[model samples]
Target: MYRYDEFDRDFVSARVAQFRDQVERRLSGDISEDAFKPLRLMNGVYLQLHAYMLRVAIPYGTLSSKQMRMLAHIARKYDRGYGHFTTRQNIQYNWPKLGDIPDILEDLAGVEMHAIQTSGNCIRNVTADHFAGAAADEVADPRPYAEILRQWSSLHPEFSFLPRKFKIAVTAAENDRAAIQVHDIGLQLKKNDEGQIGFAVWIGGGQGRTPMIAKKIKDFLPEADLLSYVTAIMRVYNLHGRRDNKYKARIKILVHETGTEELAAQIEAEWAHLRDGELRLPDADVARITDYFAAPDLPARAEGWAELAAWKKADSGFASWVTQNVRPHRHPDYGMVTISLKPIGGIPGDASDAQMDAVADLAEQYSADEIRVTHEQNLVLPHVALADLEPLYRALQAEGLATANSGLVTDIIACPGLDYCALANARSIPVAQEISERFGDQARQEEIGDLKIKISGCINACGHHHVGHIGILGVEKKGAELYQITLGGSADENTSIGEIVGRGFEPEKVTDAIETIVSTYLSGRSGTDEAFIDYYRRVGAAPFKEALYGDKAEAA
Candidate 1:
């Protein structure tokens, strides 16, 4: 919810003008593609398989109704009729014309949104928990710190072009919904016994060909030293991180090679020089940013729970949808509403222009004119009153946004794979659609429980396949597409990378394989009380592996 000031507006406007000129130069043949590639990438433009893709950042996943409406406008006027919400809490226009991207950037700028740092080897968007301000269990709002970090890192002279792309996530909730453990720098906002807010810092966590859970570089980092500490860490990584090989250039790889102890020492040594310097955040600046994210006013008791309960009792579908999509908010009379982008047999996170418009309207009417884009590839109306739940649900249902599958099996997270991404090996969206359709039954999905299935086209792990309870990685084998399945991966506070269960399956067999795994889990689970993740942890991957390979092994 942070608004742009004069300086911020001028910065973005200048960058837009610069990029506009660069684009024109490229189009006019004044510069070749090789010369224009970095410039376009710096502006969040990418030449995809068929056309160009434009990624727009939703900082800390916060947006206003005005911003959402602007995004819908871009989807309608510029690119295809729909846009894809990515795992990073960003939106991607998969079919934008190279010539029209400047216009798109200008449109975004009008709404205080931009494409800068959404791509290329720099500190990308600073993400936080979607439930940051509204979650009942949050320690504090993490957005203020995230915004501070965003401002500090944005176009920083020293760290502008790192060896590889970097990501940072902050979460104040006891539950790590932000998946901080798997980011380049994961900050878990915490309070000490003295009630002072600080962060438990984790470094080097990432998922790609080489997946890692970040190490705790600092058990507790004071709030005041945030920028300084982050700077120190970046300096260490920038200097020591590999540039010779793109594959091993990430901070995760550097951490692995240098060892956590040496890395921590280096960071600490660097911090000694930078601590209490110009980067040390002042209390006044922090307060100003915090004021921008102040919680909305809500009545202590809104008269709607009784009627809502009655409605739920009368309508099973409504009850189911509420149970799945409605999350507990800090305010008792309000609920956080998750708008599912994953409709059955459709792309996982694609929202049409009309859907976007409807969601924007709903956010303005029911919520406090604010919206949140979740890392799970969903949109959230974070502060809806209980009285407004029925109307909001009705509105969302009419818009095709009410899928009633948040955290369910059908609520899949998949990247734009072979269909759009040039780096992809196989089609991910189709696989996600097939899986969603396979488990599309409401009864079956509920029976399956809170199962997370993440699909990535390649090892880059854009879909967060490494942390999914059931992770699917599509790979190219010979001339055919093979899907590899990993079990027991989780992205929560207790983060763990999944293990491959067996040999890869052909694309056609993937759904069946997933079904077999689920079936095996249901049969072998301690009881219905035991969740898939708990059961998988207790029983290990043996049962699932046996279920998958039993017949094949015998035949061999």
Candidate 2:
């Protein structure tokens, strides 16, 4: 929702021109693939298994209705008629031509969006709670701080080529919807007893071969010190982080080797010099950014379709949808609606051009022209009037976008694995598709109760499989696709890494393996209301392992 100032616009335009020249150089043979690799990556272009993929950063997952429409246009005109929304709350065009990326970047800059930090080992896009401005219980909106971070990190000279990719997530909700615990740096907005706002800082959290929750570096950071404190933390990590192996280069590894106490001490020492310096945010600067996210005013009473209330009472289907899709807003008369990208039999995060346009139109017409992309791979209309629910629901349903399965079993989060990513050992989309199809029935999915299924291509954990309630990681054994399942993982305030159940199952056996795991939970659980996590925490993975591999088999 933030518009680009003159400095911002010029910065992006210059970067685009720079990339255009680099591209021309590469095509003219002045630069080979090896030479152009880093340059292209810096611009968020990747040479995937098939074609070049362009990742456009949606800063802190905020987009205006105009920006949303521009993305839809890009999907239709430039590449395929669809785009993939990622777990990072960014959008990916799977088939962008190598030569057309500059044009794409130009179009993106026109809408005040850029792809600068969407890739590479440098600091990536800073993610925040998707429900930031709209959440009723938020301490303060996190986008202003996130925007400050974006400006400071963009093309930063010293940290540009860091040891590994860095991620930061900020959340103010009582429940950590942003999964802040699993980020390189996590900021939770908190208010002390004195009623002054500040941050609770956590550092060194990430998922991969080594999954670790972030440890708290500081319990309370003054609001004015947010940017400077973040600088100190990044500086410490940038200096001490390991670079010996790509797999172990993250700040988490440094936290492990140096011990959290020592790491915190180093950050504190660095902060003593930087705090209250030029980087410290002033109230005027904070107010200028906050003005962009001002809450939309709504009618005192939105005129309802009496038909909708009747439908809610009479039809359980509609009721279930309202229960899952609708989220509370800070405004009394307004609410936020999550439009599920994962409909039955559809890919988890892929959205057709028409669907995007329809959602964009709805955001402009029914909502206040505000849209948000959640890390769960869903689109949110943040200011829909409570009274207009029926018409919005109908419009979404007609476009096949109204699947009320948020946070349910079929609501899967997955990465574009072997299908798109060259680093993937096995295909993740098909596995996600199969699981979604297997639990396609609405009644069955609801009866299964609250469950999360995430699939990652490899140990890098791009799909966030490590934090899923029923996490599935795709691997390759003898060039054959196999899946390894993990249970008891979650990504919220109570974050924990899942434990592996047993040996890997062949591709054909994976869906069945998941079914067995779910079935075992249903039978052993106290009731259908108990979530898969509750069952896992109650009885542990022993019984589930037996169900997947059967009684006489050994649990891996």
Deviation of model 2 at 98, angstroms: 0.9
Write one digit per residue (lDDT tens) for candidate 1, span 425-543: 99999899999999999999998899999999999989899999999999999989999999999999999999988789999999999999999989988888889999999988777
How many clashes (backbone N, Cα, C below 3 Å) per candidate? Answer: 0, 0
CA lDDT, every model vs. true structure: 0.93, 0.90
Give the TM-score comparing model 1 with the true structure, all chains together: 0.99
Q: Identify the runs in model 2 with alpha carbons over 4 angstroms from their true place.
A: 302-308, 552-555
Q: Residue-wise lDDT of candidate 2 within 343-425, one digit each (tens)?
A: 88788899988888998899999988889999999999988877888779889989998899998999999999999998899
C-alpha lDDT of residue 97 in model 1: 91
The reply for model 1, stretches above 4 Å from the true place, is 551-556
Question: To one decimal, what is the Cα RMSD in angstroms of model 1 from the true structure?
Answer: 1.1
For this target, which candidate reaches the highest lDDT against the unseen true structure?
1
lDDT of 1: 0.93
Clash pairs (backbone) in predicted model 1: none
